[model samples]
Target: MGKKIILLLTVGVLAAYYVYTPLPDNIEEPWKLTWMIAVSKTVAYLNLFSEFLGANRFVNIAALSKRQEVPPTSDENVTVTDTTFNNIPVRVYVPKRKSVALRRGLFFIHGGGWSSGSFALYPHDFLSRKTAERLDAVVVSASYRKAPKHLFPTQFEDVYNSLKWFLRQDILENYGVDPKRVGVSGSSSGGNLAAAVTQQLTEDPSVKIKLKTQALIYPILQILDMNTPSYRENSHFPTLRKSEVAKGWYDYFTTDRSLENAILLGQLVPAESSHLFKFVNWSSLLPEKFKKGHIYKKPIHGSSDVAKRFPGILDVRAAPLLADDARLRGLPRTYVVTCQYDVLRDDGIMYVTRLQDAGVEVTHNHVDDGYHGAFFLLDLKISHRIINHYIDWLKENL
Candidate 1:
């Protein structure tokens, strides 16, 4: 047993050596950042091997391998309520301070590659609490059933239903939220859902409640292109990597691990999806700056069999970037943050550009030194700087 543990550590050290996780001079406190990145990747690697040590499967309950499902209460600055909406668990955080009138409202979704975010939504994170107190807004965070344990549309359905419930007139009024001034936001995978839910509301004639604003922090907007410049450059950046993310998407779509290799080869989308290129094709939508001269080639349509087994991958609810102009046009005022060294960076870049082309108002901040999920490193100065900027945007838009 002792030898096995040493062998695993040695293997991890060697794996770390082969991967390209370098500290770019562009970033601040490079050594500290590298340490955090190393720890994050190592923990995730360990989680995958935990079965040997009698630990529960990491991807089963929460994306982070965390088992905490019990909701937590914040200190005096915020009032916390644990409840359900549309039969889905949610935590509402409202500032305890006195306000001039009804405050703004924000519907937030957490990210974990569609799996890890399951456990942290219930008033357990810092950003949501700060948003409620600092922006003087009522915030609701939904605990969507994650993938692998659940499945694709299930996570989307939970968020969509919960947002629809939050939009209810009485619900907003009860929380002292101004229905006229509400918005939605998320980071990474949650950001994808925020964009999808906003687009969904815009298209649904029955949903009269149009959101006022949206903010996406390093969001993964589509599954079509993993060869974007960021993916090629930052393939080994810590926390989120291209190969790992591709697998997460495949897992979210199906239980079969066998077909995921096809996803990596970029053929899992099948040939029929070529029609979606005009909307989500990064070659057309991404700015020349992001391209870095890598010409976009549509993934060859070679996996009709895999695509047929599960067609949900291309559903607009799963990949909001695939929505057409009519759906994109009515979207709310937007704020997008993209990191230079993150595999999914281009997802936000193309999305905000498309939103602008459709006449939706937009505010964008491209963090040159940033990597994916930077704000998740709560203790780091760079992370807090990004979070503060996001909160300030909420102050203006919400």
Candidate 2:
């Protein structure tokens, strides 16, 4: 019995090593290798232990189950009104709570890589309520129609019109929110919208709604180049891979039916203009410190058919980082959060540098060990550490 037990233990140890070890071992970058190993260990542990204890599997199933649950307090004391902006549908979130005085107001846009996301997907809807309770603020979370259906300028127009509606309604007087303290915020694609809205507001002479602050969390500020160091390093990272990033742009410009398999073969952007756009100069504006772990290379040009199919991608609104220095200078007080492991980290860093160079007041937060979409996953207990950091920053800044 003792001999049999020893043999079994040896076999188990060997199995564990094999499961955790990643093949190929050809990942050139040290950090990439380390990150891959860590992810491999995580997956190995989940696969090996999940069947026996089922803890990881159970948690995943529970999360899916939770996504189906109607948000308990979303409708209570909160009024959701449907309206049309530039022929696009939008839903606004307004708190019904009584206030002692005027409050701060937030114009929020949802994130889905500019392709998919709704106001309901925000975990902070409850937190937005708490913000209303604490800061005496009126949070307007807008549900703008997404891409492929609405196209590029349509979403931007919808958001702009939503802001116009807020101003038209005299939200400050009715909701007891201070017009001077109005702000805009969002994560990922929504962050891009927030930045764009802030820029457009600054440019518009007719619109008197001035944004006091802007919050951008891991935003995709540019769309020109995909060959940044972060992209090469985190190309295979799950959830938001390089291919998926390209696919997002494809889906945004063309409808779902237009997404043929050939497009995925790098047939989206034209070859001549592929290198003509200023993606790296604008998007790769990362601080020298952020690039210590990787090397920079000139981006390889894309095929001619690729560019011809997606010409609208070169627009400044689609790639806000490409906006000139004059526009960057006109932006409001900005707050940017970046994650070390995210492909979009450099984009945020570059925007901060541009804003600072333009003399815009900027508050920057770098999450060293955090990954993309970490803060949005706060409802999950596994991501609590990163979530706490985000909440702490919001408390101090917002």
Q: Could you give candidate 1's per-residue lDDT for residues 1-398 as a string of tens digits?
A: 99999999999988768453677888877767777766766666677678667776644335454544445576789987778999998888889889889999999888888877652543235778888889988889877886788898998999999999999888887888888899999888899889888888877877767799999989888877677778888887766778878878977888888767776776656667678766667787878888888977777675677767877767888888888887888888999999998998888888888889999999999999888878777767788889889999889878
Error of 2 at 396 (Å): 5.3
Q: Flag regions of model 2 displaced more than 4 Å.
A: 1-98, 122-124, 255-279, 282-284, 300-309, 380-398
How big is the positional error of residue 88 in model 1, measured in Å on the Cα after superposition?
0.7
Model 1, position 255: C-alpha lDDT score: 80
- The alpha-carbon lDDT assigned to residue 86 of candidate 1 equals 92
After superposition of all CA atoms, the RMSD between model 2 and the true structure is 7.5
lDDT, candidate 1, equals: 0.81
Error of 1 at 280 (Å): 3.1
Regions of model 1 farther than 4 Å from truth: 1-21, 52-56, 59-71, 118-124
Q: State model 2's lDDT.
A: 0.66
User: Would you list the clashing residue pairs of candidate 1?
Assistant: 63-116
Tens-place lDDT digits, model 2, residues 1-398: 99999999999998666545332233223344445556645754665577576564434433543474334244566665554434545444566777666667777777776756566544656545554545546777776766665687777777877876665446557666677778888888888888887788888888776888888888887666566667766777653667767766666677644544443343344565555344356335666776766666545455655545666666666667767788888787788888777778778888888889889999888877555766665434424554455445445555
